[model samples]
Target: MSEYKFLTGLTSGFTPVIDAGFSLEDYRHIDLSVQNEILSQAQLDAPEAFQKYLDNFLLAQGGQIPWGGYNEHRGLYRRSGLFSAATEEDLIRNIHIGLDVWAPVGTGVLAVLDGRIHSFKDNNNFGDYGPTIILEHEFEAGKFYTLYGHLQRESLKDLQAGEKVKQGERIAALGDASENGNYAPHLHFQIIHDLQGKEGDYPGVANRKELEFYLSNCPDPNLLLKMN
Candidate 1:
């Protein structure tokens, strides 16, 4: 069995930007739990409000919503698995493999542990994350990696592959909607134990069929973030 450490300090120590003219604390007070409950109970309960949320998210990114959800398989994005002809034709399709912490643009992103830059890329697409970075760390008993997506372009200006990064190092900054692949500004953080022959990017989420493999390779980031 693997012993996990609670990454509480890092999650609590960072000050996250919540929204325009607001802080993360303020944004967290928006009663997302109630909203989620209402959404679960009846989609019609707050249709207009929900639409407004989507609109605001789209406006922030300066792009339209992608054909499907990038973080998870359920909710609004899963209604149509037919995002594109290519995706529809694929044997294995969209699966989210990360934890998305929605916040405002320009939020600071910090490294959770000491590591080296594994790989990175500017995966810009209508629904894709803008600037993404992955770090590889080898522990005493095993090797693992952490990925940060939807980062600002400037964050990558100074980083390079194989560069050493310290724990708690400011790795990147959150990108605005326009620069962050046209989605609401948020950090998609994932823990990847195996690359599974993938580089530059891996599935941030997975479909039900592939859930077992992904879950084994990608453990809960909250083990490191302790945000919950």
Candidate 2:
């Protein structure tokens, strides 16, 4: 196989990092259901402070945070071991490796570039990414993979491994909370340079110690979507 194309010819604009020049206050009032979940779960009582932290974090990570008033605190829970007893395995599992774009159910999710369907499956479980799809793209000197999680069932109806997909194709649609493994509707976009012996499911998040490996394998997806 050719060294896969690292990055080229991707475009952005459909997804704005800051809600089309709207202020933080404006995002707060967008009336989306997921915003309520963010406010309640993330405890984002202070919008300005939260937004500042989110912006700074994304900038440092080489990606742009998506708009829509949802702030993703990657590695926070993993670092604190809030999900369970602080075990090495548990910690290694919670660090999120993808950029989650908060949006409503039924949102149209387009493919970032031309590629072949590498694999896909229905991952039904609590706190899991529901239905998912992974595409393998070949570029000039490199090959890469993109994973889309929490997608509606319709998205997977006719897709299959080795199927060809065009750039900007409507590969999948957003799933609702109930069908999306019990979380709010959102797109968990991830890039993987190496599958690392796993299939059907990849680490949507990781722990502190495993950060280096996950980050290296899963580069900032904004490189393709430019949705930030």
Candidate 3:
């Protein structure tokens, strides 16, 4: 079966990755892409300033969680050398491949499905997913993975590879800017068809040149999230 068909089959309704206390009604789609005119380049490069913009956005929309980013062409990654292009010919990895759930620090992050821990790591790069976790799930046809990034430190301290986690289980908590690669507190949730032998991490962003392949490998998180 195709990736879209398989992913949509995995969940029957809105699957909560952030704290379950916040219902689907609390989720509001946010645009962080270049299309959003209000997002200045300077603010996108500053975590505190970017966070303030997010705060005002939520307040203005009367939203608790501003969730979006899958396949979005964003200007948010230009801040970090990890994703920035050094030369004019270099490919810029600014298209986000994962769905970002914006929330406060220490918010509970739950497993979207039953799976075993694949690996864990603390990616400390300035624009990286700090304290990452990848979980492996098996189906009749094959296996796939879900990655939880930008997590609190304690989430990894007690975790081990191959650990079993059930759906809705508290697997991690959102991390603040200090520990979570200097981004505002949020969960970068990605679903990967092929991990490409990586662990505790995977490309959460892609460039225009490689957009097609990346989008196929990392299907839209909304297939499972069903957040309207």
| Best model per lDDT | 3
TM-score of each: 0.68, 0.68, 0.96
Model 3: per-residue lDDT, tens digit, 43-157?
A: 8888889889989998899879999999898989888888876464338888999999999999999999999999999998888999999999998858999999999988999
Worst ten in a row by lDDT for model 1: 24-33
Per-residue accuracy of model 1 over 15-48 as CA lDDT, tens digit each: 3321223332332212222224544423312434
C-alpha-based local distance difference test score of model 1: 0.61
Ten contiguous residues with the weakest lDDT in model 2: 26-35
- Measure candidate 1: CA RMSD: 7.2
C-alpha lDDT of residue 117 in model 2: 92
Clash pairs of candidate 2?
3-141, 3-142, 4-141, 4-142, 4-143, 5-142, 95-205, 95-206, 96-205
Name the regions of candidate 2 deviating beyond 4 angstroms.
1-92
